[model samples]
Target: MFILGISALYHDSAAALIKDGEIIAAAQEERFTRKKHDLSVPINAIAYCLKEAGIDVGQLDAVAFYDNPILTMERFLDNLVFAAKTDDTDDLMKFSYDSIFGTKLWIHKELEQALGGLGKLGKLLVAEHHISHAASAFYPSPFEDAAVITMDGVGEWATTTIGYGNKEDLKILRQINYPHSIGLLYSAFTYFCGFKVNSGDYKLMGLAPYGKPVYYDLIKERLINIKPDGSYRLNLEYFDYQYGRAMTNEKFAELFGGERRYPESAITKREMDMAASAQKVVEEVLILTAKTAKEITRSKNLVMAGGVALNCVANGKLLKEKIFDNIWIQPAAGDAGGALGCAFYAYYQYYGKKRVIGISDSQKGSYLGPAFSDEEIVKFLSQNEYPYEKFESAEMFYQKISALLQDEKVIGLCQGRMEYGPRALGNRSILGNPRSESMQSQINLKIKYRESFRPFAPSVLKETVLDYFELDGESPYMLFCANVQEHLRKEFSLDSLLDASNMDMLPVVNQARSEIPAVTHVDYSARIQTVDEERNPEYYRILRQLQKDTGYAVIINTSFNVRGEPIVCTPEDAYRCFMRTGMDVLVLNHMILYKEQQPEFVEWEDWRKSYELD
Candidate 1:
């Protein structure tokens, strides 16, 4: 039976399709709508999935939604107990809620509308938010049975949940409700640090290594009350998110010493320290929760899915603690992955289908999005009159790209299927020589047009993973950070730099902390993606060719898009990004286009205004 899944009316809205328990296609609405973190109905995403599956929307045997609107409304009304009319909530509802919630609560009608009247439609099921998250975590994991943890901002009435899954059955054993959320607490710090809540939390995580966790004690004592078992309560007096749009109130600002920084403003030591403090608290809470999961469920394997699970630094620390013998994190851990999860819930839980164990995971390396064949790419380039060269073979492609990379050329790769999650992986990535000391600054300022403080990730060959980063097993999704090997790390003096009253982060960011200076962060840690031949053979072959030519099996891999833009979803999107950026080369399937060979391109508008900076 075919099943359609959807996560919508929240951030990272997406759609997933599965046939006979096999996942077929998935895509985010932001890709098609050109809106970062688009939360509308994922109509475009649903259309794409239907096309990829070679079926009409009405062909689906069943449809599942990631969240239950009734429960979510209950939680929203329950929060009124603490603060009523704090920020003119009536105005808030009238402003956007009427349009948003009215459509959302009647999602069945919307689904029917999208399905073109829903011919022979089966059950339209809705799973609770955290239940969807838990199903997403445990169902596709490599483990036969595992303890599941889902932690994010308020979802229905749950913010955090601990559960156990065995075969097709999953049960929630514990829950921490809304208003006492680890995700919201961290998001408050994210806003105070001058970043967007869901979209910019990773930027806050990236900023943590630059400063000390001096506010750790203060945050624990005043902002949140944490129990040894990992359940926590938020000090509601300090936060304003319960009532309105603002994450924090004046009390929170006064406690921190000043008002929250403006977006895209100066990054001071205060912001860095706060990021570090919040990151530390999150790591501690996650580890404590994992320990409790092991104690209660007695399961050695653990699976996780949530927005907070996107914090790779916290994930790395939890992995290091070894609270579970194994951990499998949903790559699309945010609400987007909830689409995939709810589908699994419908097939396995609602329909009582048995889950046949997989050797690794059902996610298929998350390379499940649209892919352009060489013929399609070449046809587009030829028709557009774009100057390009078509490689004769995979070997020729790999050899030439490896040489170009060694010459310090930054290449944007749009090959194979797009990655399902936030990470670029190998298919849709901008690659650079990691050994180059200035590559990070060059890419950040000249290409990405984002903060210089953010670090790049390394896509390393899985066989040689131990040669570089201190990591075991596989990290195919680029979801974990590990320290550089001791031999590769260089001795650096940061004590004097940290002591400076006016600290310039540029110097700290530029410091060569390891042999692969571009990918290494200030703390000498790298978010590593272990590449194997099985999943993405073409990328694996290119790395192998690079290893053969330069003796280094690693290269820098960042998403192939400019700041605030979603990763390129089409060949035209890829070409536009390449033309606008300072990238040296653009690889679209087998065709390669050089910057100097292309004609001068005019953007639709002043390119910077095209996207709101995240």
Candidate 2:
């Protein structure tokens, strides 16, 4: 049976197709639309999946939406009624109610429209929001039985869910309901720290290590009442998300000792402290929650999927704690993964089909997106009259790329199948020499055109992971951070440490903190992706070649896109981004193009303005 799964009308909207429980294709709408966090119905994404499966809409046996819209609307109505009873019916609240009521109440119709009409589409199956998340986490995981947890901003009436998945059956054991969400609490801090809420929570995570968590006690005391078993409730007096569009109220500002930090304004110690405190709180709750799940389910393995699962720092801490024998996190742990989850849930639970477990995961390394043939790439290059050279063999190509990395050239690589998750992995990545002390700043300023504080990830050969990082297991999804090995770290002088403060950490951050300085964060931690040859042979070969030449098995890897843009999806998208950014080389399949040899790109008038700053 062909099942089409979708997550739309929310951020990171996406579509996925599964045939007999195996994922055929999956992609986020942002990739095709060139809109970061595109929330519109994933029409383009749905078309891609259908085309990839070589089937028409009529061929689909079922269409499973990630969440039930009716239940979601009920939550909205409940909140609206509560607001009315409290005599808090203002224009903003009314607008909120009307907007949600008009736009969200008719999601079934929207689904039909998205599928090119209900007549052409098949049966419509609706899965609960958190159930979809849990299914996505456990169904595709290698574990046959595991404890499951899903936490995110309000979904229907649930904010957090604790569950267990055993083979074909998954059950929700306990839940923390709406209005008291860890996700919303983090988002509120994200907003207070001057970042976009949903999208910038990770930025808050990235900023955490820069400051002390001095406000941890204050946050727990005044904002949230977290329990020993991880069940928590927000004080509600300080938060505004329950009734207002803004995440925090004036009382929240008073508690934090100031107003919300203006976006793009100067970064202060206060923002850093808040970020640190929020991150600490999140980590504490997650650790406690994991323990509770383990105690409840008595499962040695754990699976996690949710927007909060994207916090690699917390994941790393949890992994280090050894709460479970093993943990597997969905690569696309956010809403995008919900599409995959809902499809799997429909296939196994709704249809009562037995699941065929895999040794690793059924995600196929999260490389279930599009892959262009050499002929297609050649055709595009030839048609565009682009300058390029074809490699004689894969070995030769790897050798040449390795030499470029040794020479400190930033190369945009588009090879094999595109990744299904938010991460670029190797198929779609901008790679650099991790050993270069200046590589981080160069890529951030010249290539990515983003904040300098953001740290790049490293794609290390799986066999050599322990050589550089203090990690015990595979981190194939780049969803965990670990400190650089002591031998690899460059000891900082006492003067440099004393001079570094929240306001001016650039001096310290610019210093070589480790052998692989480009990927190493200021805290001496690195978000690592262990590249196994079976999953991505080409990328593994490249890293191996770099290791042979430079005695380093790691290379800097960042998503293959500039600021405010989704990762490049097509050869055309890769070529445009290559020409637009300061990257020195573009690798399209077996062909390579040198930036200096390419035809002059007529700069658009203020092209930077085209993309909205995130």
Candidate 3:
């Protein structure tokens, strides 16, 4: 049986398709549309999945949506009544009920209309928001039984939920409702810090390292009330986010002793301190929640998804605590992963199929989207009359690219599989030599066009991760953190280290960490992707060749597109990005296109520029 899953109308819209309990295709709508976190119906994504699966929409046995609308509406009305009871009229935008319902309740009929109504499919299943989030977390986990935690801003009414998933069953134990969300708290700070709400939270996480957590006590004492069982309630008086909204209010500004930071303005000690404070609070709440989930379910293994699961720092702490023996996080842990969750939910929940014991069947393998054939790439290039050359073999391709990389040239590598998560990994990545301190600044300003302190990630060979990092297992999803090795620190250190005693205070410094420093964070920890030849053989072979030539088994790996645009999904998109950016080389399938060889411009009248130019 074939099953389709969808998450939309909220941020991070996406789609997933499953056949006989195995994930066949999955992708976020943003990747195809070039709209970052597009919150409309994922028509392009659904069409791509159908195309990938070699079927039409009519062939699907069942379709599942990630959230139930009625339940979500009920929560909206309740929150509105609660807001009025407090007489919160001054903070009209965020605390009003109409604003909240308008964003959530209005999407259902709109979605069905987008889906071509009931005539297109025989049955449509509407899964509860948190249930779908919980199912997405546990069902694909490689554990016979695992405690599941789903945390996001607000899903219908539930902001946080705890449950357990075993072979064929899932049981939700308890929930923390809306107006008391860890996500909203973090997002409030995200907005106050002058960043976009849903999209800017990661920026808040990145800004934490630059400041100290001075507001921790104040936040805990005034904003939220945490209980013993990991349940918490927000103090409605100090904030507003109920209706039409921006997160914080005048009271919040006063509490913080100032107004929100202006975007792209000076990055003061204040913003940094706020980031650190919010991050610390988020970490504490997550740990407390994880510990509570373990106690309630008594499950040794844990699986987590939802937007909160994207907080790698918090996830690292959870892993370090040893409360759970193992943890598996969905790479696309936000609403995008809900598509996969919905598809899997249809398989195990609706069809009553038995899950394979201890199997994570979402062949997602990090690379789950469309990959262009050499012929298709060649056709596009030739039709556009773009200058390019073809290599005889994979060895030749790697040998040439490796030489370009050693000279500190930025190379856009678009090869075999497309990644499913926010990270690009190697398949859809821009590569650079990481040893140069200037590389970070150059890529940030010249290419990424984003923040300076926001660090890059490294793609290390699976066998060589230990030589540079203190990690023991495969970090295929780039979720976990491992410190750098101690031995190699001396080689890269610019300052003098005369005494061994100095090392005591600098535990994370000068570790033989993955030979790539730009990608490594301030703590000498890296979110790593271990490349094994068996999984992505072609990409691994390229890395192996580069390693042989450079004596380093690592390369700076980041998403293929620039800051605001989504990762490139088509040859046209890839070529346009390559032309616009400062990249030195474009490796499209077997064809290699040098920047110098291409024409100054097509300047053709027929060129419509319909493809996303960014």
lDDT of 3 by residue, 135-227 (tens): 877776778899999999988888999999988798778898887899999999988988888788888887776567999999989998888
The total of clashing pairs for model 2 equals 0
Candidate 3: residue 133 Cα off by (Å): 1.8
List TM-scores for all candidates, in order.
0.98, 0.97, 0.90
Give the range where candidate 3 is weakest over 10 consecutive residues by summed lDDT: 503-512
Residue 497 error, candidate 3, Å: 18
Q: Please provide, for model 2 over 398-491, each residue's C-alpha lDDT reduced to its tens digit, 9 standing for 90 to 100.
A: 8999999999999999998889888999999999998889999899889999877789999999999999999999999999999999998887
Better of 1 and 3 by TM-score: 1
lDDT of each: 0.89, 0.89, 0.78
> Residue 291 error for model 2, in Å?
0.5
Clashing pairs in 3: 93-244, 99-244, 485-511, 485-512, 489-510
Residue 166, model 1: Cα distance from true site in angstroms = 0.6
What TM-score does model 2 achieve against the real structure?
0.97
Ranking by lDDT: 1, 2, 3
